[model samples]
Target: MSKPRKGILIILSFFAIYVIWGSTYLMNKIVVTEVAPFLLAAIRFLSAGTLIMVIAKILKFSLKITKAQFINCVIAGFLFLFYGNGIFVWALKYVDSGFAALIVATQPLFVIILMRILQGKKIQSKSLMGVGLGLVGMYLLISQDTLVLSEESSIGIAVIFSCVLGISFASIFVSRANLPSHFFVTTGYQMLTAGTLLLIGSLVLDETWTSPLEWSGKAQLAMILLIVFGSIVAFTAFNFLLKEVSTEKVATSAYVNPVIALLLGWYVLNETISVQSLIAGAVLLTGVYFINSKKKIVIFSRFKKN
Candidate 1:
């Protein structure tokens, strides 16, 4: 590919991740209004996973996996989707999507600790500072007053926090494990596994299924957008960008997601965003940047002369 073409593709791929993934919080908020969280999550993953498999087959990519691979994928799916995603959806009923995204944004802080705990990696002082900042951000975002609103709300915050930790561990595990060379294929299997497990969970929880015919236009649109853009296109783009660009650049999505989710939540749903949430979001984003970055940003360093 020409340099210009490559750059354009890279920009578009980043756009997909930043915008699509960010929009998904709002999408989840919309879908969960009528559909049960587990059922919605189950269907989303099952469909997206199937779509990816089909696309891979059409492209003549290998889709076959060993029995052990399937089992590993199942475990990853359970962590990444069934708990990380499914529980987040359920929590949205109590917490605002933007608030949930803010909590989810603290994922890198957990990842830093997980890496140290699991692999015996050394945590740097800056990384420790980042973790501290992230904790304060969470406290501010979920102010004591907010937590005292109801027991359900407190549980929701806790569940979302757990999901962040769950996904952090899942990512570390997937990286260490021997999986398929095809990233999408691995993602497909993980989604399928999570989808299947969550489907069972839906039945176990006695969640009612609302027919497609009965879904509101907004709900239907949210599902379609989430399946097509959020799961397939954006995720594929993210995996692609990991290969093409510096991981530091790709990690910028961590900061961008909350802003997009917050704006969309406020604009479309008119969800109220508190000043504390904004301040906390800023702190949380700074912490994530510190966690991902190897060097101090020294803010506005781009303007410095070489």
Candidate 2:
């Protein structure tokens, strides 16, 4: 592919990822009302992971790895897939999809802090400002009457925060660890490991499995779309794009996803979008823009100097 064509393809892949994955949050809210949260997530990841593994095998993708690489994959699976998505699934049981999405969108802010702490690097001023803005946005998201002081709401907030922390830690660890060169193959292994953990958790914690499925046909269809498009296709595309595109460009998905999720929640779930949400979303996006833009400006300046 020509450079321009390749860039366009990467950008399109990112857009697909943002839309599909963002919609999954609302779908989870719909489905979790009927399906067991852990059970549903287990099924989604297991199916997607199995399909990816089979494809990798058929393509003759090598699993050959050093012992260290295997360890890295295992840790990443636990942190990213197991803890990240697992907590997210749990949170959906109590929180509105829009609220959950707003919290999760703070992942980039967490990632920056985790990177600084783990790497012992000095924090950038822009990044600290982004973190502060994200914190303010998060406060705005949960300060409403809907999210106040109930036990379930508190638990849901904890779950969402746990997921954010897990992703932050996982991202930093993965940055320094040795990973497979084949992105699909690596992601397959991580997904498989994470899915298995979720399955085990479901079996242990969820005692009654015989509850009649209570979802409408529409919700069922949404679940299928979540697994196929959201978990499998979108995630695969995201991993591929990460390899092809700059991280800053890929990170734009963070901003795009919240907007998509908010709109979907409003239309499908009939959730009210508060003015606070709009303002917070805009502020969060602005912070992310400044943080990423600073990097680009630095690179361009060096190029000009050279």
Candidate 3:
């Protein structure tokens, strides 16, 4: 590929993942207004997975993996899409989409702590500082009266934050596992597995197929957008860009995501944004930047002069 063309493609890919993934919070909120949360998520992933599988076959990509790899995919699928994503959808029942995104944006904090606890990883000074700042930010975000959750929003925020553990552990697990050579193959199978399980769960919950008269056109369109743009296009772009760009650069999506969610929620849904929440969100994103960045954070250094 030519240099300029490659640059354009890279930019396009980044935009797809960043903007589309961010906007999905609002789209998901819209859909869940009509369809059952887990069922909507199931359909979204199932459709995306089937589409990607067809495209992979048409392009003659390898669709084969070992039994162990398939099992790994199943585990990751349940952790990531089934639990993490499903819980987020359920949380939207009581919270604003933007608020949920803000809470979910603390995923790195949870990941860092989990690594320390489970793997005996040493926490660096910079990480400690970032964690401190992130905690303060989270406190500010949740505390309506500046020091405590005002009863109404506590459970909703807690529910959203709980998914962070699922996603963080899943990410760590997948990082250590020897998965398929093809990104699409792994993601497709993972999505298919998650979708299948979610569908079964929905069935067990006695969720029947939502009729056209029951679900609005807006809800239908939102699901379609989530399946195509959010799941398929954004994920393909994300995997591609991870190979193209620096990891820290790709990690910027973590910061931009909540911002996009906040903006879209305010603009499209007319969701109220508190000044305290906005300030807290800014601090939270700054902490996330510090966590991802390599720029030296010199809290203090102890050196013995010889």
Winner by TM-score: 2
Assess each prediction's global lDDT (C-alpha) against the native.
0.74, 0.69, 0.73
Candidate 3, residue 130: CA error in Å?
Answer: 3.0
State candidate 2's TM-score: 0.79
Give lDDT: candidate 3, residue 206.
86
Which residues of candidate 3, in runs, are more than 4 Å off? 1-18, 91-106, 138-162, 211-214, 237-256, 271-278, 296-306
Error of 1 at 149 (Å): 5.0
Tens-digit per-residue lDDT, 1-306, candidate 1: 798997898789988987888899789878988899889988898999999999999988899899888888888888878998777777777776547756775776676667667665566787667667766766676553432234477788888888888877776666556566687888788888889999999999899998867999989999999899998888777655655553334545766676677778888988888887689778867766665564853320211111
Candidate 2 lDDT at 144 equals 61
TM-score preference between candidates 2 and 3, better one: 2
Predicted structure with the largest lDDT when compared to the true one = 1
Query: What does candidate 3's lDDT look like per residue over 50-115, in tens digits?
Result: 999999999999999999999998998898789888866766667765466556656666766676
Each model's backbone clash number: 0, 0, 0
Off by over 4 Å in 2: 1-6, 58-60, 63-66, 91-106, 151-160, 210-216, 240-256, 294-306
What are the root-mean-square deviations of the candidates from the true structure over C-alphas? Answer: 5.8, 4.6, 6.2
Clashing pairs in 3: none
Give each model a TM-score.
Answer: 0.78, 0.79, 0.76
